[model samples]
Target: MSIQDFFIFNCLEEKDLPLLHRWFQEPHVKKWWPVPKEKEDFFDSYLKRIHSTEISLYFVSYGNIPIGFLQAYPVDRSKETWLPKLPKNTIGIDQFIGEIDFVGKGYGTSFIKKFIDQLLAENNEMTVILDPDPRNKAAIRCYEKVGFVRVGIFPRKGDLALLMRYN
Candidate 1:
């Protein structure tokens, strides 16, 4: 079964952090974001804020078995590190398929596509933005396939990426 088969957004709970930590240690995650060395630190310090931010929302799902993590935040409200002048209330999504076995099953793409559609519906004036590493060509292609356009590049602390906008 795919994420499309049973995709719903739910808030991240205390019990969910164990699974999230497992996902973080997976090979797929390390390949994409390889800085954090400890899972305890990530959750205690970072994941605690999943519920507070109105502009940023996170979901925990059992995508055919609940083995992934997904998060979306307003472009203006979340990480102001690498985006251009976003539309007034625009939201940006940053997600990952941590289960290596689930990597190429179209789950990640389907989840984001559906989620973005819902976000846009709510904030019609918003523009969704993303910045995928230019080195990761496959990801760039996937974003383009879903109607995101390469807007420009912005440099972050460690990596520089191709900024994309979905309007």
Candidate 2:
């Protein structure tokens, strides 16, 4: 199905935290998006920054049902060393399909493409970036399918990551 067939991006809300926490606990998701050992701790820390001006958090929905999480922030606001090489208006993204049933279904590529299209439409001068673990071949392939090019690998938070850009 096209993105229009089953996708809507909506602002994350407090009510969504429980499902989000469950997603975080999933082995596949936790490997990439590590959270606190306690769910409450994770909720406390994440909720505190959900509405930050420096970033935007979204829930990816399929026919109005939330299925995933996505976030975007200015590259300059990031602590990653490689982000400084990009233009100041560059934005970085992080995303995951929270619903296990949706994994490997090609929704990620469509969602990312549509989301980036919207971002570009809203800000003509902005560039978008994504950093996924190089070991995650599936994710790398997905990003490549959405027009993201591999720029290079960089160390981020004690791990090496593959940096991809869509401009």
lDDT of 2 by residue, 1-167 (tens): 56656789988888888888989988879888878898789889778768578788899998877889999988775476554478888888999998989889898888888899899999989989998999999899999999999998888778888989994
TM-score of candidate 2 versus the correct structure, residues matched by position: 0.93
User: What's the lDDT of the predicted structure labeled candidate 1?
Assistant: 0.70
lDDT of 2 at 15: 85
Summarize candidate 1's per-residue lDDT along 1-167 as a digit string, tens digits. Answer: 65455777776777777777777777767677654577767777556566467445455355446756666765553457455566676666777776677677776777778778787678677778887888888777778877899988778766788888884
Best by TM-score: 2
In model 2, what is the error at residue 126, expressed in angstroms? 0.8
Which candidate number would show the highest lDDT if scored against the true structure? 2
How much does candidate 1 score in TM-score? 0.84
The residue pairs in collision within model 2 are none
